[model samples]
Each structure stands twice: as C-alpha cells, then as structure tokens.
Target: MATEEKTLVEILEENNLIDLAKYVNYVSASQAGAIATFSGTTRDTFEGKTVVELRYEAYVPMAIRQMKSICSSARSSWDIHSIAVAHRLGTVPVGEMSVFIAVSAVHRADALDACKYLIDELKASVPIWKKEVYSNGEVWKENSEFMDRKLELGKTNGSCCRRNVKVETHGTKSCCGAKVKVADGAAAEISTSDAGTEETI
Candidate 1:
C-alpha cells in the first residue's frame, strides 16, 4: 500500500498579478475548520516620501525552494491541512498586493500561527529582493525580519542552523555569510509582518 502525504503545500512565483481568491479557495476544505491568510500590499508613502510603485525580483527557483521548506517547517510545527503561497514579481503599484498566503487547519490557532509563520519565515529566509521607488529618489529597503536574522547570524558566528539563510543588505558585501550587492532605485515591498490580526470566519 502507498503511504499518503501528511500535508499539502502549494507555492507560486510569477510576474503577473496574484489572485487572492484562487488561493483562498484552494486552501478551503471540508475538514478545515479555520482558514488564515496574509495579504502583503504596497503602501502609498514611506518615511514621509511619496512613493510611486514597488519592484520585486527573485531568484525564482531558489525562492520557491525556500518557500517549500518554510511550509514544511510550518507543517511540522502545527497540524495544518494545507498551505498556498503566491508572490508577484515585476512592478506592483501602490495599494496593490505583492504577496498572499493561505493556511488551513482543523483549529483556528494552528491556522493562524502557521499563516504568520509562513510569511515571517518567507521574508526572513527567502531570496526575494524588494526595491522602493520614491518620487525624489529610490532605495532598496531591507525587512526588519531580515536584518534581525542577519544580526543573529553574526552573533553566533554563522554557526546556527538558520545561518544558511541568505539575506540582502544595503551597501554591504556580505549578509548571513553570503555575498550580495544592493541595487539602486530599488523600492521597499511589504515589510510589515503582522498582516493584521487573525480573523475567525
């Protein structure tokens, strides 16, 4: 007899706009009592600067791989039934969504926690890079999650298990023991990890 998989994970990275409804529907199941989601959207202003739009680039293959790993980790930590993640590349206008995640579980806690974990880990560990474009000028912004992870790596001398995660830092030759170059005119994507509070429905 063939053994069934314990959890189902779905990941997508594309240059086209993401369809939130599709993901929300995909993770919905009869057995799932709760569905938690995170939608990362572009904001209008940053640091008091007028923003035009945001740009995102990723090492697609590696990004998807890391996302899968994060999903697996979430499954191990929680009794999640399914997960669906989608990230948009290219240009995402202000007030538009850049990333979306959905998680389903038998209970609300597992769904909510796994949804949050998926986004946080994705921001912290994934190789996707974001650039913020302002009216006057533009700059590549680093996520707080990424910066914290970088600092933790330095403190442990890159000896930690999560040290293998590579983060891109501005004006630096190395991040998390990996070399990277910061590109100019880069816009900041979604940096807030909270994604609002969990809603029961």
Candidate 2:
C-alpha cells in the first residue's frame, strides 16, 4: 500500500486583521517535525519619517494566482508538508501585522528555507501595492526584489515596452517610445507618450 501525500496551500486576502496563530496551527501536523513562520508588522517609522499607517492594495485575482505559483515553486524545491500565507489589505496601523507565512516539513531545514523563500518570492512577484502614509506625506513603495525581476524579464524576453532596446547598466532610457527613468540604480518610473500614463515600477 502507498501512503497518501499530505499538502496544504492557502492564499488569503483579508480586509480586517490577520491572526498569526491560525496560520501556524494550520501548518502543524503529526508527520511534520518542524514548523517555521514569518510575521511582517508595520513599523512606526521609515527613513526618519514618522509613519502613521500603511494601506495595501492588490489585484486580488492576480495576487492569489501568483501566490499559488510561489507555493508550487517552493514545494518543487523542498520537501514541504504545508504552506499558509495571509496578507492584510486596507489600512494597517503601526505595529500591526500586515502579512504572515507559515511552513511545515519533516525537517527543520526544509521548513525554515521554504518559509523564507515563500515570503521573498511573494514580495517580489505578487501584484500587491503598499502606500506608506507619513506624518507629512504619503508615497507608494516598491520592493527591490520586484525591480530586479522586472529588469531580468526585460533582458530575457526583450519585450520591454514591446521594443528591442539596449538595456544600460544604469537604466534603459526608451522603450516602445516611452521614457524610463531609473533612480539610484533602480528602475523607479516609466512614462509612455502613446498612452499618456506614468507608472512606478
């Protein structure tokens, strides 16, 4: 007789608050010897600026799809038993939890490594946006991991802005008749004249 495979993958989006314990408990199992978790809390400050709160927005369908992909990727790389991921949208006050991740495996190493990879990949690829509200102003934030992936995609597919342009070490100035500006060695903004749209990458 063959034993059944036990696997759990949950991707959740909540407007209210998130309970970390729920995720930890969900990943716990009899066969799992180790469980690892990550809790992301909103801080009170950023770069010496006082942060009032953080507001998160996501393309719900795409976010969930990407999260599922990430979980599948983790399972392929490690012998993970389960994975639980929860992200809170809307307003999250200072010191409040914004995201939580939990992973379980038969060994400590697999659980720990998979937990880290899940969060990192989620932040890098998920279609989630964060708005940091400071005492004086508010700004949208982007993760470096996402930016790096964008650059990598541009290099690999050669479809940046649907044009084949030379990618500079610092930045690509034009793509599909759009001007791209990379700030501080990171691609920060892209503007297109045809669409009259400006976006932050």
Candidate 3:
C-alpha cells in the first residue's frame, strides 16, 4: 500500500521567524489580492508552569489525510486559489513555529476565513500529538487547553476516519434515482438497483 508522506516547513532546529514568513510569501504570490496566515508557536508556559520544549509525533498517513481533507474543504467553501499547511514534528523549542497555515484568495474575507478554519480544523482533527517537555517534567498533551475548550463548545467538526458513506454529488435527484443497500451479515451483500432497472452483480 502506498502511504502519504509527511512534510515540515522547518526542520527541528532553532526558531526562524523569517523562514516562516518567507514560506507564507512563497505560497501567497502576487496573483492573490489577499493572503491569510496562521502560525502556531511554542509557548513559554503551560498549565501555569514554565515550559521549555515540545516534542511532536504523528501518524504520518492519517495526518496527511486529515490535512488534505482540510485543504479540499477550504477550496470548496472559499474562493481560494492556493493553500499551504505545514506542521513540524520532533522537538520544537519555545516560541518556535510548530505549525503554519497560509491561504490566498482573490478577496481578503475568504482568505482570512479559510485560513482560520484551516487552523482550527487542523488542531481539532489532525492526529499530530505533542508532548510538552517542561523544565520540571515531561507530559504528553495531545490537544491544548484551547482545543479542549473548543471541543466543549461543540465547534469541532469534520470526518477523521475512512468510513463508507453515500455522497450526493448534485442537488438534482441524480437526474435519476437509485438505491443501494448494504446488509450486515457474516458475508455482507451490497445490492444496487440502477435507474435503468438493471442488476448486474
């Protein structure tokens, strides 16, 4: 099976704000009237304690799937021409860019909205987990307090797993109507009846 690879905008090194800005600029070219960017950096404090560094790990395939889904959704919802999202794994120091999201659009509103949505969805859905290595101790914090709050507020939404789902492509009743049923059994059977009343299985 082919697996999706992971990519990081910056390697696990010292913080470089200029590189982040340059990446954003690279993604957002002169064709776009507005460019929206969101950069998440390591914080100096966590849970009222001083923090030093953070180690991030991810299920590479799943993380890539989630990111691609985010980009697809943004493209469908907003009039955006380009989008780039990159998150770092491995050790990240305090005040270093952990994730970067950039979106470009013909107008500012769609770009900004899509950028914010991309970041929020990435935080909530992406499988990248972070271990906060405090100056005192080490603790794995998958989602931050803000993410927890968002979850509590019921703002997180998206599909994170691959499940069988029936998708309607157009508003028209397919210009036709067809029904397919999958029965649950030891050897499940999927029955499909087409609009032409033909059954070939």
Candidate closest to the true structure, highest lDDT? 2
List pairs with backbone clashes in candidate 1: 131-186, 131-187, 131-188, 132-186, 132-187, 132-188
Q: Where does candidate 3 stray beyond 4 Å?
A: 1-18, 144-201
Stretches > 4 Å off in candidate 2: 1-15, 155-201
Give, for candidate 2, the lowest lDDT window spanning 10 residues: 170-179
Q: How big is the positional error of residue 158 in model 2, measured in Å on the Cα after superposition? A: 12
- The number of clashing residue pairs in each candidate reads 6, 0, 0
Q: Which ranges in model 1 have alpha carbons more than 4 Å from their true place? A: 1-15, 155-201
Tens digits of per-residue lDDT for model 3, 1-201: 221212222222222232566556555656678878898988999879887777666544456555777788787898886776766666677878788877778799998999999898888777666766666566656476435645676756523222222332223111112222223341132212221111111
* Tens digits of lDDT, candidate 2, 39-131: 899999998989888767654445555677788889999998878787766667899988888888989999999999999998888867677
lDDT of each: 0.65, 0.65, 0.59
TM-score on alpha carbons, each prediction: 0.71, 0.72, 0.64
Clashing pairs in 3: none
Q: Looking at candidate 1, what is the lDDT of residue 195?
A: 29
What TM-score quantifies how close candidate 2 is to the native fold? 0.72
TM-score comparison, 1 vs 3, better candidate:
1
